[model samples]
Target: MERPRRWLEDKLWSSFGPEQASANLRQALSKLRTALGEDADLLQTDRASIGLDEARLRVDLLEEVVPGNERIELLEGLDARDPEFEDWLRQERAQLQAMIARAGPKEIRGILITCRVDETAPGRDRMTCDVLSNQIGENISEQVRAWRQADPDMIGSTDAPQSDVMIQSQLVHEGNGHMLFIKAIHQPTARILYSKLQRIDRLEAIMQSETEIARTVFEAADQIVGKLPHVLAKDRPETRSTALSRLGLYRMFSFDQDALREAYGLMDQAFRHDENGLYLAWSSLIRLTQMMELAEADQAALMEEAVELYYRAMELDSDNGLVQAIVSKVRSTAFGDTAGVMDLARTSLERNPTSAYALKSMSEAYMGSGELQKAFDTSARACSVARSSPFKHYWDTGHCFISIACNRNDEAIIAAEAATRAAPLSRPAHRSLLALYAATGELQKAQSVAEKMAKIEPGFSLDAMVNDPAYPVRTLRNKGLLEPVRGLL
Candidate 1:
């Protein structure tokens, strides 16, 4: 690649004025030439522009050049303290990662989805059925493609009959309405991976229920992808990466130090293989979770890493709704950037209305801004959309906090208990339950929750938590809600 001198100055030293930027660039190029020494001739430059001799340079990132055993990042940790340069670097890294992924060995899995209208069904509108089928198919296709870990090649059509899974559906008359019976069958194993019946009361009502139906089926298919590594037993890097990512996601919610460390390692491994925006976002979320659960003294280091990872994730895939949602949560909790969190969360919801994660983040932003009513409503939506999801505890925890802030003690207790039941190993969930139990004068219940917390963290201390600025206990104390729990501890 060739770059004009002016462009280089603006990119590398935008923080400084033009004169200073130009001088700094010249000084940096002079040092680079000195370091190049014998390879100095490869650094081709003119009065107007600078270029590298691509023919002579053996760039490992290029498709033609094979990579080494050691993993290396392009210009790793080189920061010019300029926003423009940082943006450019992130884009370049994303492009390089994409190139490498295309060059690597991987498997492309496809789903052959077909919908047929039952001839026995009365008053069946072909147009309506076609529209409904297309909508559901498109929804599933979009959801699958969004998950880079799954590595879905394409949604197979009649023209392209090849597929790993066949999702067949039939629309038939039901009680005063129609029912769509859907089943996902693995092509090789001939196993039914998923089976569900979606009820549509009316042809017009199909639009309303389509999103939910697609989500249910897509999540099931995603689970199958998570287990593909075991079944295929091939050296498929993408399948292995998906398996690692799934394990990491489950472990990340444990809120235990050792489990979190293991989760981070797993997520890091997946990110290394895929280098995807979602992978980076998940890794960043793990870092933020570690920051919350780790000792206050160790939080600073985790915070720095989390911030860098989230920023890079955003830069690589700002349009990705899930990526934006994860980054928004990090910004809301770790950086306390309420304005940025609200913007990112809102955009995420706009892009993917079914995303419970975005809804939770938006609710948190509202709570932090003292918009209790908005927070409550948004939190409720989060819970509703997250129905039966394995990660429902996350939304429930947010709802518990919002309910507490709104002085809905009964609702708060319900949500807290629900969160605790959903994730028994989650310290935050236990803390929420304990807080609610204590605040409502349930001493025995509070003590039981506290005991569970102790089991999760052997060195659990109420005093330390209440005083530590890193924990949410400080916020609860400021609100005059922790005094009741303090007496029990």
Candidate 2:
């Protein structure tokens, strides 16, 4: 009900006073009318009544955007000097909040935390996180509640929706390129459901990225989420295998020795339950990784086991590019067989040119052999495939190896540092960094890297590192750089 002019007069009196109160009200009403000119019918007013035309007015926040609990305040910064008007505004907001709480993210469950948009970062990358977040919304295949930022009260509490899966996304610029990394996290259990790292330099191609970026990221985001429903499925062993393999990959890239082995065991279980060639290949790859990083008891034995696994993988699917890629890497790293590496890499790439695993093997083959430039080129391609990926750093170690061989010591140091940052758990990255430091005659840095490597893989020896087939030709080059450190070890 419209209180008489006396009411509004009191509401603004503290600031505007009664004299200007009426004038202020008239002005505000006029402005309101102008703002709502097209929807003027929604504002119902008569001599004795001032109210919204209930039937004509529909609140977008309340009716749409289900469980829209995102709003935290109402009429913020407005000053209704009179207590009654202030109370009215508060009550209206409370009513709206009640409605929102009642909605309770029903149709949409689960949370998605996109990295905060960074304002200080350079290039179109400033809003890359936000663009990916918005893109995820557009392409999300399932109905899950999402938030740019989660409400404080909802975290770590069972009272919130039981949706266990959450997706955490980050956009990073590595050296010269932009990378988008996304991971589906199981909130309650605190486990990763799935994760993805994709190249996003394509954003630069957009006419106006601020406006067009989301569309490009949308397809990328969708592709990841589209696989989520299946990958995150708990009932299916094959699906669980997919999830475990992803975790294994993350751990492998990060240099987490124990975690990767655990993933390998889980993959074994998954494979046994359902004979998935993917698991077999990954299992074999992880075993080989142990030989290089954790210092497997018998390198030859590990190599033998890996080859047997790959044989089965090939038997299961001769055309599996990822399996083929790992086999090529094993051949390269174990035997220093450059020709075999080259042949397998080409064939694997032919099956899946986009496979980073294959590209990495190709890079390793070139570095181990005498093709430093081609190795560099292939490593660059792998980094481009997923620069934000841990695999990028994995391949980057080889890239640095090639760079050092090419007499690009300075560049090699930079690439080595980047590799270490990308995969701190990586023994090879640390070794590369140490070798680069020693080669540059920076014994102090080399000593520091040696200590770090020892902590991760106790009693880490340069002999084990230098003699390994990881970088055959480069090993000879780093031998002098490493010999002095052998006594220190």
Candidate 3:
């Protein structure tokens, strides 16, 4: 991501005055140019910003890791004798270590398939289950191998024996038929990345024709493989575009001003690497989330950029249910198009009913359109469906707000607590908890949460919230259920 020259000075030369920092940066850039005498053009610079030619650089920190290079230190022998530089380097090293550890062993592996049939099933049913499991597994494995081969990031390890994805199938007999469950688990997070449940009405149908089942399996495999790039991006550094997008998500979830800016920059870089519509959706979401979190933030630029990104994402992938779900989330905030937002959310849900993301968007749209009961109900469903998923915190946060809107303080408190546990740095989560606690007359707990929020977001205080009109005091007051907390704030 490119950095504004002023940001660079503040980040790297924090110990120096503004004028001195600028001069020092100039000298540092001059020295760097001299050091890279033959490749100076790679050090890109404009009047206000500085960046590397990212396209021409395969930064080891963001690229594929060698099979046995986990122990190697980043920039092993390089050091700058400055406190800010040391802090930045240490942070990068720690983040890289965390990513590698999460990725598990470096040895390449292929997808592992496992099947189970209920031991109490009839002998004939068991036999049928075996045949179906093996056939489906074989088909899925073939497609997975083909997918790995086609991916530029996994070019050389296409023949690995095992995969990061674990496809598990379980068959259990019902009264007159059977239920088949297939789920793809991303090993690193132990999360079910994709799942499908099917009912077999008659065993004879399977023996006579496997066409319907085959088509279902094929579609499941396609969707499973489609999710791999994103799952791997979080674990593997080499999937640069996906990695940036994943990191951006974490940063945005923090709901901090500086972190939101960093998230935007990361998503921007990721979009440049791969014009994936989802990246644009994520970027737009970051903007909207930031505006919603910080009541006093300048909204004009954020709103404009968010709407533009949403439209661009639609142009790029209008049919993608996930993309539509995400972009629709910003519509209510970005343009106050409540009806349009609900329509988009409905379309997204129609395209992918199983998507918890679409459900979350729909819940928010319902609230925007003054359907509080519908918002609460949909938010609850979204939370239920997103259980143990990678982004469950997002749904939980939505549920917290909807529950509060419905005067369900206890439920709102539970959801808010869960959100904070999932993303401890999130200002919004802490703020919600603070309000809930205060409303319930848990003054001590509410004050503690306020302290935590202050730590997460500097300058945040109950006094400021009470005195500042731009703060969310008015919105919280309008919620009605938070009446008891208004005096406390």
- How well is each residue in 1-489 modelled by candidate 2, as lDDT tens digits? 235555656655545666687777677777889998888666666554356766665443432222223476666788756776787788978976775455332222233443334455564565555545444443342112233444234354445444434544566767666676766555556666556676656655332332234333333443454355343433333333344455456556665657666657756754654465766877788778777654455778887888888778778756656667777877676677778888888887665444456677777777767788888887766655546443568667767766766777787788789888877777767776787677667888888887898788765666766655554234535545555555445
Distance (Å) between predicted and true CA of 210, model 3?
A: 24
Candidate 1 to truth, TM = 0.68
**lDDT (CA) per prediction:** 0.69, 0.60, 0.70
TM-scores, each model vs. reference: 0.68, 0.51, 0.60
Write down the lDDT that model 1 would get.
0.69
lDDT of 1 by residue, 171-228 (tens): 7777897776766565577777667777767666554434455355435544554545
lDDT, candidate 1, at 200: 67
- Predict model 3's lDDT versus the native: 0.70
lDDT for 479 (candidate 1) = 60
Those runs of model 2 whose alpha carbons end farther than 4 Å from true positions after fitting are: 1-232, 254-257, 334-337, 461-479, 484-489
Clashes of each: 0, 3, 6
lDDT of 2: 0.60
